[model samples]
Target: MSTEQTSPAPTLAEDDVDLIETTSDASLERTQRRSDAIEREIGEDPTRFRILTGDRPTGNLHLGHYFGSLLNRVRLQDAGVETWVLVADYQVITDRDGVGPIRERVLSLVADYLAVGIDPQRSTIFTHSAVPALNQLMLPFLSVVTDSELRRNPTVKSELEATGDRAMSGLMLTYPVHQAADILFCKANLVPVGKDQLPHLEQARVIARRFDERYGRAGDGSRPVFPRPEALLSNAPNVLGTDGQKMSKSRGNAIELGMDADTTAKLLKRAVTDADRHITYDPVLRPEVSNLVLLTALASGRRPEDVAAEIGDGGAATLKKAAIEAVNDMLAPVRARRAELAADEGYLLDVLRRGNEHANAVAEATLSEVRQAMHMVY
Candidate 1:
């Protein structure tokens, strides 16, 4: 296990300072307005949009994954928008030493997706390694970005901090560029992201714009080879772990989607909470208890305050029971479906095989266009 060290914040250059200012309250308000308009437009004409979003197959997805992203992916696919979900397998090695049972984890991830109503038929689910042409775009994408830009990316900086004393790998340093390739390879115009991830999307947009200006036939009749993708900011509440911190698989605090009801109940029993016998929703004052209330609200489709009021004077035991019941009830169907899918490994492989074939076809076409634009088709 890597020990996390607290290092002093790095000094920001002038350009980095400007980049940080973009996330200020006023800028976030503007982003929210744009997101609202996009939501309305999506409802009006879903076919005009294409969304690319996904997860790295590091482990079984937990509640954080469900509420934060998977639910929204299902909604978009069901809304008639073209959706592509990438299993970022190669990215697993960016921070870690080796891929531990990557094949098993990938299949398990597919099971989780299927369990949660991600219709593979409606959405394309493919792995990063399966699409060679997609990775090939990395060369051009990397060329458009500067070393300072890559290092200045907030996501990269945080990821580096998380790795402790391990030297940042070249792969890790260029993670953002590879992500740009993932988005551009499919010509995806919309990407779902949280506030912290906005910088990564911006980097992708920069690469797209720079590549278009440097190599694209702008003055002529042809359109740019890649679209500058915009962020579709998520409105999901940040769900904390049982330990009163952000839920994460590595932290061992996450309640995985694959856990059975009994297992879930057992985990909730061990969850931390306040000594107060009365329950109330005060995230600032009573974060641990409030986190449980929040989870219950998300699971039951009720408000957090309402749940807390109902559980008033019920104490920690009652609070844990409510969370366990609500969460298990919500996840019952997902767990059932996951079990059935896990039993059929052949079916899972077939899903990946078909998705890979489709991804390859799309990536090859995009690469051909890129080669022609750069005058490297020969």
Candidate 2:
């Protein structure tokens, strides 16, 4: 989901507004763009690298997932570079409390990934719960990172104060450390993430670098063992919930995958729009209407501004009709593909097992190096 949607709404609670932290211009634009020369090089030789990224299976994915990361996942996988989709199942317990739904949610999430065109054969998709050794790496990895670093992470801070309770549970604070295990376990050379996730990735980089510096230097004084992995950033698409809030399951504002057309239409009917009752492209003035335009543009492969212009003076009603048509049209094919795949749970299981095996081979090799370096080898 886009950070824009998942962020705390403008109306803040007393606990949420604690101290009102801010960002400087330099940090604001960090990783917003990469050096053009490096981008060109990656495009010219994309297959020379591997990508690692994933989601915590807290809830079913939503429209925010589609425009932000799901679409990117499909595009990246189609590009022929090695990609891995991880289900951070344990991370689910960090902030959310709905353990009852987890088993169903994880299975549903597996279905959603398949439904959304994450080719199991092309991209490695596995659950964290199934991997014991990878989780074992977390205890050692935790030793290298300091507490201040954990407390200062912007994402962690945002997550902590998002609700009134201020959830800084050990699991929540140590999330980045767990995330480091997720990426480093795969021996991944690149992590595709949004700007908000850069801090978490920074922690991973720190751990990888620290481990190598302290342990990877051989008796002969060779270079560090870890890859010194780099972040391969992609522009995450902006999306909002029907209420013009950030799309999130917690806020009850998300449009989900696997929704039938009837349900989608009902939700879109209640979607927020401009007060002037006119459909226009001025996102600067009309975020609600513009969000609808964005939804259509993403679904139909047209520019959002162009979609607004096409609706002209007909107002939001016209735009809604057009948007619904475009969205349902897109959903029809995805639903059809998903139905076909749903007939075989056995196939999905095999795919995940194979992916785990491939992932485990790489992770085990890296962990072996780590153990040997730290003199922990059996």
Candidate 3:
């Protein structure tokens, strides 16, 4: 029901006026690059239906997570999508060194999800590993998706170096098929994604079409069994780590979403800053300072320019301290929520189990239709 217009243009708080305009132009060019407005209507349906959004259960969520993708998921769920947040536990191993962290970290990742206000009530929180039949759908879905489609997935190309496994594992090579299962398993109609994930979303839509073409036509067949799940492309930026590198656990630069006060302070104290000392927010000209300022602004719900002004009268040390305080203040209520959840082990488990049950109900509904379409059922 929200009929809000898309904002003027997407820009980082610290983006210069010119850089912001150029970025907008580049976006318009991409839109013109493809001659279709059909794609614009992809995830805009207002039937008040299903959404699937998730994170790789690699590590604890963090500040970067909040402003990056998680915030939008929160918004969507609050806006009444039957939102499902998958704890992609098994997918965490695709590029990782080993499974040692899986057992401990996966649970903690769930805690992070809960702590960050991804309510178990509003959003069903279930693991990728929890649903067996959905994973099984991967092989069959893979049979229909093209090898060219596999290669063209940008995530594949980017992960190639990270995994160091040029010899494609069936698991890594056809991750899109798995993703299609993630969506189609629940008859999901909406998927929130960053720009990097558009190809996979396209493949999901294509796979759904191909399945219908191949299996949906019979003596009485006239309709596709699956709906084309649409992408809710994220408007959030790729949040930088404290070191101004990509915010990742492997990089050892990410500020975790569930850090204790002392640890959070220690991390920010060591965070990178500019040498010139004057406090301003210009990401292109001053990445380090701008990142800190933006983080502070995002966490405090202040505009970047306001943060710039707040720091303008002060020295670099004062700015850093204020930014740190702002971030800490933001983390306070979230941390409190987490602590309350963590203390009540039974309540947390009940939430997870209840959510899993509901999710299974959804999955089973879709699986039944899939079975009927494939003629595997009476």
Query: Model 1: which ten-residue window has the lowest total lDDT?
Result: 1-10
Q: In candidate 1, what are the lDDT values of residues 1-378, reduced to their tens digit?
A: 222222322233533653565578987788779989999999999998999998899999999999999999999999999999999999999888999999999999999998999998999999999999999999988877778778878878887788789788999999999999999999999999998888888778777876776666323427988998888999988898889988998898999999999988988899999789999999999999999999999999999999999999989999999999999999999999999999999999999999999999999999988887776755
Model 3 RMSD vs true structure:
9.6
Q: Which stretches of candidate 3 lie over 4 Å from their true place?
A: 1-47, 162-166, 217-220
Give lDDT for model 1.
Answer: 0.89
What does candidate 3's lDDT look like per residue over 1-378, in tens digits?
Answer: 232222232232322331223235575455334313323332464345678878786677887888887777776666666788887877766655566767567567677778776878678888777777777777667767656557656777677766574566667777778888988888887777665566667678777866776555323567677788765656686568878888887788877777887788777778888777678889899888888888888878888878988788576677668777988898888888887777776776677688778777777776777666666674
Lowest-sum lDDT 10-residue window in model 3: 14-23
Candidate 2 residue-wise lDDT, 68-150, digit = tens:
88887887678766788898888888876645677667667777888888898889888887887788778877876667667
lDDT of predicted model 3: 0.71
Off by over 4 Å in 1: 1-21, 163-165, 218-221
TM-score of model 2 vs. true structure: 0.87
User: What TM-scores do the predictions have?
Assistant: 0.93, 0.87, 0.84
Indicate which candidate wins on lDDT: 1
